[model samples]
Target chain A: MKPSDIFPTIRPWVEGLVDVWPAYIIKPQFASWQVLHILSLVVLGGVSILINLRLIGVGVTNESPSEVQRNLRPWMHVGVIGIIVSGVLIGMANAERLYDSVAFTVKMLALVAGVILTYGASLPTARADGRVSAGVRVWFLVGLAVFGLALFVFAGGELVNPGVWHMILAAALIVLIAAQGAAPVDLSGGPAGAGRGPVRGHPFHRQAGRLRAARPGKHRLCLGVPGVDLRPGGLAAVHRARSGERQAGQGHRLRHHPRLGRGRRRRAMDRLRLTHEEGPRGVGPSTTPGRGVRSVGRPGRGR
Target chain B: MLRDFLVWLQTELGKGPGEYPMSWSEALLGSLNFWGLLEGTHLLALMLFAGTIFVVDLRLLGVTFRRTPVSVLSQKVLPLTVFGFAIVIITGLALFYAKPLVYYHNIWFRAKLVFIAIALLNILLFHGRVQRNIAAWDTLAKPPTAARISAVASLSAWIIVITLGRFIAYDWYECGKPIPAWANVLQECAASEHGAASLAEVAQ
Candidate 1:
């Protein structure tokens, strides 16, 4: 039920994992392995701090938010690779003991989540236009807080219990960071009255300004609307009116969907009815009419 | 009749929760030769299982290859990962069949299965909501909410599954007292005395 109950049996096995080439690893006399391990720890630890700082908005304040992100981010990945490689090497020196140590597992998870979140959240938007808005910055802070809390909890776990609880906390922290990283960031610039609103520049930012300025058909092009809100039939009515004006001919080059504006589809349906009634004499389908039907088997058959 | 079957199972497959040396289902997995193939395949299966997990987890965490685009990486890695997964499942089944009872009664092993189930369910969500947004992310700065959550869940589940898998090697889950680490000095807890001592300490 408790960790102590399992440690003794696991100790020898863990020792084996850590002691395979004790000369290269555990021997304080060898100095090299310990040095690598410490170096990895310091580097990973430092990067973790910086990334957390950036997340908290305290560290990268001097740089444009994105610049701060760009600089602090790459190190996060390097730190992860270093920690993993070094941790494994050290653990291998005393593989058996390290393998079974709850302390080690907790450390691994903290590192994993820390590296992942730091790298992921700053992943430039695919549009190459992604920028950090205030909301995104807040998520970064959340991630940073979670990461630091995880590290502290993990260190405490190692110092105190090095039991199931420690590993559980570490895992929880890492998972939290990863969760925050998955949020979307809108890179676009914003609309009027940015105050008392959702961070205005994200994907959902208003398309209202241009729609109002539209000289017919422009609203249709602005599918991603930011501020403009239309009532149930408002958009349709507006569309109907603009399309009606377009039919009057201002020589606008826009591809106004005639079908939507004045229900051209209804007229098309009427034409189809006339064609069906008059049959081949109507012209279009009558000219070729599915050649397969006449040449192959049955007439008036469609492909 | 069902009661009799139940008693029979209790004597055999359905042994006590903390039971061990409860006998292997196939004794020696049906002779040494058959067992060797099973073990070898099991090793291969493990690689598959672990590899898919690594890739999926990496993707979820956004730890991607620099040379490979996200969509490309996903395309290339996913198939192998899924293939490896299939190998693991088949191999795992073979191993389990080779000795169902030990696997069944092993508490840590059962816990591993539970985590794997959860991890698998998380994968289902990954496929459903998250995967759908792959094309859209390029146009939009960020993916949708559902994708983000699925990715996080996938990453978390894999970590838990890995941790639990590792736990299988560490925890002495079969015994009531399982005086494992503490018992480094004393292997078993045959008597109630050690269990009582543990019960007291844990109580405190």
Candidate 2:
């Protein structure tokens, strides 16, 4: 069914509501709605950008995708609610004009596609906590392809007027490619290692330490131990030694080093108590804090 | 004195097909679909820029990313914010170049400029003063009072800037219209006699 046929049927209901409400009667009402719409879009688009960037292993590389999603979920909810309420009001005010606008039709379709891509595909795969499976990755590409196909069919396969769609498609393609390209290298503990890639003898050992420190609960434990150096270089040395032990089949020896040893580390951690007033010292401005003591006892697992 | 210079600058820039034959600003404004695309880019870049700033400001206010240290969030997110800011500035300049006189005479645009100035000053205050002691409160859910105040100032400034920016598209307080005396002074409508005469002609 063509959108032309569908829009006509819905036109009357919209027009009737517009007549009753007459949002345009007030001089500033429609403009206020526009401001609200754009503001909501800022929130929505910003959250989406950050999440997508994280998925591609670009920005906020320290936090796992799942954690980033958790942190941003409330803002996402706010953006969604604000956009919908303001969008509906704007639509009601301009029903007649929007009824015949091909751009508006394409926008609604694209909005639906975006929501699906984000929630159905991106969110689910991200929630996998960097272990995105081959199947899920394929599905993500498929979802992106569907959006492109929708644009082609609806917008007449031309680049005319809908330059925004072209930009969106190009950006999505770049993000997907980057994510896919980084996946294998990441598995081998490369600089882009976002997953649980082993860091044994990696050249980017310092970066690896910073990345690990970015994870929740790890940095706090590192900081809580008073004497142990919490600098990235210091952490990297510990990581390198532990990884070397693992590589040389000396996993058992990890228990001997005071820093890596589980029993001593825990005792050290227990001895130095942290009050909110006395924050961790000597930690650099860029070093992230841990979420809590959740990962204190269980150390050397992911790193 | 500034108003006089601005008016002179606008007059020089607005020279076009008749008198100057082919002016840069005139060419930009006359290009088909270029203005629309420029406006679209300006808005998109604004969203990206403002959105990233919003995230950072929220963090500073201790409203979000409480578990994460302020430094880490800033380190990771500020780069994206800078990227967005670059695009916003570039496109914003292009938008202004397209019609310098109109925007110069616009009350809302003037108000937007004031807020932008405030936002920039707040940013300076942040990086210069508030950030020096960030390590002390890096992991705290809430930052120091100065940092929080900076965040509030930044938020209010940007919000007002954006609202005023949106209002610029409306003709309610545009020049050549019956605006209040104070608004006329603020917009400096009298500074550009040539612009006012041209607008009067257009109005007729």
Candidate achieving the largest lDDT? 2
Which pairs clash in the backbone of model 2? none
Q: Per-residue lDDT for B1-204 in model 2, tens only?
A: 665555455456556557447556767888876777777777777777888788889988999888888888888888788877898898888888777778888889988888999999999989999999888999999998999999999988988888888889888766556566676677876664433323334456
Residue-pair clashes per prediction, in order, are: 28, 0
DockQ of each candidate, alpha-carbon based = 0.01, 0.36
Model 1's DockQ? 0.01
Computed on C-alpha atoms, the DockQ of candidate 2 is 0.36
Model 1 CA deviation exceeding 4 Å by range: A1-303, B1-24, B30-40, B65-72, B138-145, B178-198, B201-204
Interface RMSD of the predictions, in order shown? Answer: 17.4, 2.8
Model 2 / residue A269 / CA error / Å: 43
lDDT of 1 by residue, B1-204 (tens): 533443344346533445354434444454545555555455444444554444434444444332223464455346545755786677677676554444444545666787788878877767775676677662332345665576677656655554554444443444455344444223233331223125344555
Cα misplacement distance, residue A253 of candidate 2 (Å):
25
- For model 2 the local lDDT of residue B189 reads 69
Worst lDDT run of 10 residues, candidate 2 chain A, spans A292-301
Q: Where is model 2 more than 4 Å wrong at Cα?
A: A1-6, A9-11, A22-27, A133-146, A153-303, B1-20, B192-204
